[model samples]
Target: MCVKCDNCGAEIGLDGVCKFCGTVLPPREPVAPPPVAPGWGTPPPRPVFSIPQPRVPVQQPVQAASPKSRWVAILLWLLLGYLGAHQFYAGKVGMGILYLFTFGLCGIGWVIDGVSLFAGSFRDRYGLPIRV
Candidate 1:
């Protein structure tokens, strides 16, 4: 009977080696697949309704106003507004430096800041209003 090498598709010799590709061939036999359980082929049915999860209430943190006084900020602005002393007092170091270099945007920003301060609309670096 003729036996062929599975790897190289060449005729296998009596020593079970493929003469063309030098591959050893195993004895030819019919291979059967493993038997499956009767009900394992199909998946289990899913539930029609899903359970509702409880909602959690999240609370936000509250920030208190700055302890710095508005009157002191106003005073600093009046005295050295061009130098951004009020900005520094209000914990706005970046704006203070900008104001110092640009002379409070050539005094225009100084006037606007003074208006906002007197009108009770000015805020500190922490975004809290500086009132009273």
Candidate 2:
């Protein structure tokens, strides 16, 4: 026997509703996974990541000092003469800057400056010999 929907008068099936009746259906249950065998016990290994760093040379801070005495200038010449430390020490700023740029005129001017400082003939920026 065919059952009829009361609202639409259409033929219904075992689901108790006809196609044109717009009845709501029940929700389905979630599916379960199949059982695993006895011995699958090892954990997954972790991935290793290596990060690269940029290469840069280390630098040292410069300590600049300008001394007033010829003795100090001579000492600086003996120690850091090629770098124009003596000219800076003697208060010859322009010569010091030139010496700094030219590496004491490729060490020849450094030798002459050292000798002049020792001989008491090296003059300051004011044309005055550095005081002992």
Among all windows of 10 consecutive residues in model 1, the one with the lowest summed lDDT is 25-34
Tens digit per residue, CA lDDT, model 1, 4-93 = 878878898989899999998767677797877878776768879989989988889865667889999999999999999999999999
Stretch of 10 with least lDDT, candidate 2: 22-31
**Top model by lDDT, which number?**
1
Clashing pairs in 2: none
Q: How far is candidate 2 from the true structure (C-alpha RMSD, Å)?
A: 15.0
Residues 18-94 of candidate 2: C-alpha lDDT, one tens digit per residue: 68876534433656866665566555578989898898888897533323688888889988888898887767778
Displacement of the residue 108 alpha carbon in candidate 1, Å:
0.8
**lDDT (CA) for every model shown?**
0.91, 0.77
Clashing residue pairs found in predicted model 1: none
